[model samples]
Target: MLNSLLRISQKTALTLVFGLFSGLASAQATTYYFSNSGNDSNKGTSISAPKKSLAAATALAKAGNKLLFKRGDAWYIPFGLFDLSNKSGTRNNPVIIDAYGAGDKPVISNLNVLSDDGWENIIGTTTWKHAIYGYSKALRLFANGVSKYKVNTSDKLANETDVDQPHEWFIKEGVINKNGIVYMNTGSSLVAPKNVEVLMVGSKPVVLMENTNYFTFRNIDFRGGSTSNIVNIWAPSANITFDSCIIQQGAGSGIQAGHSGQGDLTTYVANINILNCLVDKVWSDYENDPNILLSGDGIFMLHAVEGGLVQGNKILNWGHSGISITSYILGVHGVHNLIVEMNDVSGGESAYTHAIDMNGFEGLTTHNIIRRNYFHDYTVTGHILGSYNQIYSNIFAGVTVTKMPRHSHQGWGVDWAVWRYRGTGPWIEAHHNYLVNNTFVSTEECAIMIQDSKANPIAVSNNVIANNIIYNFGDIAIDVNTNVAGTVIVQHNNFWQENSTEPVARFKNLGTKDVYNAAELNLVLPQYFRGNTQFNPRFTDVAKRNFTLTESSPTALKYGGTTQYTSLLGEDFVDYFGKKWDPFKPSMGAIQYNGGD
Candidate 1:
């Protein structure tokens, strides 16, 4: 909180006090508690007379209010919450809804799990179909808290089954049915798993922030939505946050931070902070459309949601990408000036999907920071697409995807691309972008890939990739395909290898111009060579993941005592180990050196 305060300007502080804390200064704060055992008619002032429903607590909630749900209590389908709007508290005393007196985190689910597995077997086949209360739109089925691929009626699941054959599902009429027999092998038969749950689509979110502001939700477990987000931030509000909450298992995206109302981008959502939240297991119900884009995701920051901090979130498996910060607009008012840091984005379930994808389809998405993240095991950890963004101080461990069979191209540890909006040229110039001081270890294809989308012809220029450390094993370390006419800066990066290999090679797909890392200068001087060196940045240990360099490393002052990198990588920053940074005397890669710092 103090760090945040220190970053705010004097004018911004006054606006926060007046706009966010107006309610706190005018009225005394109140505390309300809710529990499963309490009644709706209770005063809800004390724990004994706490309110029963979330509706009652929200109805009475106001600024400077603390709404605490009893731990181990749950608010199920029949009593789902209404949207919270029009009410807000000040920054000093924001309205907080949190868990109290815990057995477990308070659960707020929109669907009931089907515990009774009274499945009727088919006449001849080994298939089974169970009756369910069906609803309109797509239906999502989950077993063991994971999304089951909805099977098509025409696809055969019999001879095409594998060793660990997937349990594909298809809905028939108002029932859930499985295709083919449950035979895993010639002799053994597979039984239907008991932990089956279905969710309906098209409903209000479990916790809807419709035109709401200045509120904080803490330590609450939100799950089980029906084609709706566990939490949705609707249009035209700010100072809203979700902190330290368990946000998971929704039929749709975990958190939807936008509202496509009337197409006004100037009056967009801003100052939103999603801090230290656990967003996991969110599945988009695409039974209706499997080819749907921008659906299942951990956190979808859409429609011009800008200027916020998305920090310390552990996101896992919500397909289209773990975290997608985008806007689907064309003209102006782009989503920019955001900080996405300290998040652990891992494990992609969908093909050709990345851990994070920030596309500026809406407007010129620029000036955002993607730093200090630990990405691993994902099909593509991040930035299959982005522009004018700063990506630095992040670790890429066990990066996957030797080649993108989907895109008919090879994948890399870091990718940057920009697409024009509706074929309109110059959406956002991919200029002034930076990828610096990052570490990529044990990568399959390459370390960094910088490309200019065909639609974005020449705007993808003036980007910088510097001071990086790569343990790239295959192909090239930096493969830049400048299909357009501008140049990208590459310099001062250290490449480590076990065996003899040309790690200093710079392969490019530039039409007529050739670019290479100058050996004498030790920088990738586009179109010519100045200088380069095979500088071994003697590390303490590499096998145990200790990337701290030895005191007598030669790569110190590798940039030649130049502070030019301060603009690209951001100054006064800490390294991977959270040690303080000295911009002038900087070390390469994510972590700062005690001696090197």
Candidate 2:
């Protein structure tokens, strides 16, 4: 009897344990569907009966639930998406927001249209006015899905009677007890207020993740935002991801992630991945405020981010820099271990911007990698401004198109600058950077330049530049300051200037006010110069911007050995066009010269 009782107790304990795990599994399997045609009162567990709004679905969400929006549908939320604060998921079972039953991805915009009868004509003028109550400020105005020009003067809405352009608008903000007004001159006798929409900047983002963790968003089209980016992930959040999405048309950045306050590295947003997305048109003509620093960026990893990956994104037509990894705050913990690879960034001539800019405080930012990307048609290719950063195997081209008409600075292919500010903390300088195995072509001025913009004597030091092919440069091929002479290494590079009379390298002495050429530079700093030759790289095409090497090119065997660079870049890494590098002997430039020479 005693043996039978013990067996029964053991069986009951096993049954209870199994029941607890089964309950937890069922709780995690809850899936909610959202559609425009569904009713909210029904159970939202199936596609047949779905929820109608994000608020209802958000209220029912748990740690591992999936919230799927039906494709070919549009939702306009006046306040943007739900605020995902303190609503998190585990690493294995993250909260998901995606599309289903697709004809196209679901569109989520941040605007509210006025009714047809919501407009009133202003007295003795062709302009019409719409009064909006309880909103803070109007950011952008759209008529029939087209952006309108905003008047610069704030007094034009209340005082001007001769505003005649159909696409011009003005916003008069509210005072202590008044309502904000939006005025527009449609220049038509019949006013269609229903076709007009306004995006308000009420300190909200289209999709906000603050202090939340483990969320994945995929295949959603996000548009029409104001103050912040389309998707903003603030700090104390980790493992947030965005994949295969279209993010565009914002007054601010496209996608921004960062941490602020007290400079604590422990509170950083960690492991954020943005992959395979289309980010375009991230600037607005109405954003003329000089105080707004975070505008028109394709992807911005702001002051503090750790282990972030931004890869495979096509960024086009941005008004400012394409990808900016910056830590602008003083005494803040800087961005660390961020990898940016395989991106195609192109900008128009109207906007003078850099393809990539890494701005950070010295000794705080380190170990960031930039590799295998194509940057074209920008005023500057890159501004590498951090310590211990490695930039390799990339192409920086097309700054010579129209000479990017700037008054303050000359256009260069790659610029390395250091600035030192007087502070109580450590001195800021650019040191121990590696720029190797790259191709630079068609720059207006020098192909590569290093200078202390603030004119600090010892601001830049201990950098390496090796195994590059510089073709079709305007002025000097390589320009370095004299203060960084003994500490920098310039070796194993091929250079050919568009003007044949220019020197292969120029070392400017800031203190003595003298310049040194290739032979003169070799005499002064013989230890820093090795195997640098002046040769034509023999590119396949120059006018059409095809930079592949010809079979007879002399640069095919110019790289000396791979023993020094292979340990910096790991053993298994591909070249620019996905060709493997020979471990014993690699080619000179970004392309690995697969054809026989």
User: Which pairs clash in model 2?
Assistant: none
lDDT against the true structure, each candidate:
0.63, 0.69
Tens digit per residue, CA lDDT, model 1, 327-363:
6655435677778777877754544446777776523
The lDDT leader among the candidates is 2
Error of 1 at 130 (Å): 5.2
Residue 165 in candidate 1, Cα distance off native in Å: 7.2
Q: What lDDT does model 1 reach?
A: 0.63
